[model samples]
Target: MQHLRVAWALAGAAAGFFLLFLIQAHLFGEGQLVAGTCEIVTLDRDSSQPRRTIARQTARCACRKGQIAGTTRASPACVDAQIVRSRQWCEMMPCLDDEGCDLLVNRTGWTCAQPGGRVKTTTVS
Candidate 1:
């Protein structure tokens, strides 16, 4: 009976630790980070090949209200006023090796997908 009790206690503690880990990921995952690169590629629009990169700007965190991780928003994420940077990524067709680039949330942003439709990160910016 004592051995069984010890086993149960250990199991319970492990479960508790796993639960906390999940909660932390939800509240402060990489998605919540106010950082990402934005690029402007020169797409042929009619071609099914890789596009050329024309312009790129160093971006700053410009998250909207309540976009930060965790329950508390310590400071608002703002962008540089002097620079005109894209708010989202993949503004043009940048997919390579016959991959596809699909826009998200309408035509606001875009992402590269493999032939199997799985998203693959080709470039950070």
Candidate 2:
């Protein structure tokens, strides 16, 4: 009957909407995902001696669904997926075998310096 078909369609629509809502809630909910801890080592430059001391540090970070844990200059925190994929400082192997990649000072980009003194820079948002 026409009424029976209409009821089934309405039920199917409602189920689809519910499924969508559940998926959104699972991804965007308040609960955060732990990306894990990271250990960092650096040179301590403030010392008066000519030789720098090695400074060791650890950081525990939590990131959202699309992010991963990373260390910024100031602290440990979440980093965007695109930045990780881009693999700054030659991690992505963007340059030729003989060339080198250097992370820019601003931390928003990188430069591939060639043997001929040519520099190619790419910026990420």
Candidate 3:
């Protein structure tokens, strides 16, 4: 009957709307996503003394969803090293200019200092 058809259409519309809301809530909710900071440090090696300090900076880290594809190794996104890990025993490279220095970002998200300042921190996808 006409009335039966109308009722079915209304029910379908309501169900569609409810499903959309649930999906959006799961995707956009803040708690569902994780974000954090990373620091990188660069060290100098050539100095007369054994120990030297170089530069430092911070970057942002976020959690992503995916399964490991091929090997036992985890995805880079999940286990990327911070700056500190890279510089633990590395020597420092000379600065490019007064404001420049040889540096890299560590797993912690910090960069070694350059002549002018530390490298700017940023986020990657």
Candidate 4:
């Protein structure tokens, strides 16, 4: 029957749409796919920081400490309460073997990169 085939096609299309909606909901949480009216904002990142790992946050302190890489839905955290209170500077030579470190003016600097990279060093006043 011609009408029977049309009904079967319509049923398949409905099932496909339902599955798609369910997948989107599972990936982005419920009601996130609703049009407009979302609370998202960009964060303040250091100008010198790499652009490869930058993200926005929906709320304050939504990410873990020292997370420089994240998605648009989540924000990255840099430094926790304990670390900020202690005022402890991160160690130098964070690179593994085959990587070079830039000591610059201070023995404990935070600039490290691959070998043969341009580095800056100036004497303290």
Q: Which one wins on TM-score? A: 1
lDDT tens digits, residues 1-125, model 4?
Answer: 99999999999999999999999889999445233123344554334665343233342333344432211211123333443333222321234455554444443323335467643221111
Tens-place lDDT per residue, model 2, 1-125, is 99999999999999999999999998987544445433333433245545433234444466667766554433455666676776563454545666677888876766668898877665554
lDDT of 3 by residue, 1-125 (tens): 99999999999999999999999988886544244222223333344544443333232345333321110111122232332234321222222233333333542222335554445321222
> Would you estimate the TM-scores of all the predictions?
0.34, 0.31, 0.32, 0.30
lDDT for each candidate structure: 0.45, 0.61, 0.38, 0.42
Q: What TM value does model 4 have? A: 0.30
Candidate 2 segments exceeding 4 Å error = 1-89
Q: Which ten residues in a row have the lowest lDDT in candidate 3?
A: 67-76
TM-score of 1: 0.34
Top of the candidates by lDDT: 2
Give the residue spans of candidate 3 off by over 4 A: 30-60, 63-83, 88-98, 102-125
Model 3 residue 73 CA deviation (Å) reads: 29
Off by over 4 Å in 4: 31-65, 68-125
Candidates in order: C-alpha RMSD to true structure: 14.5, 13.3, 11.9, 11.3
Error of 1 at 32 (Å): 2.0
Clashing pairs in 1: none
* TM-score sort, best first: 1, 3, 2, 4
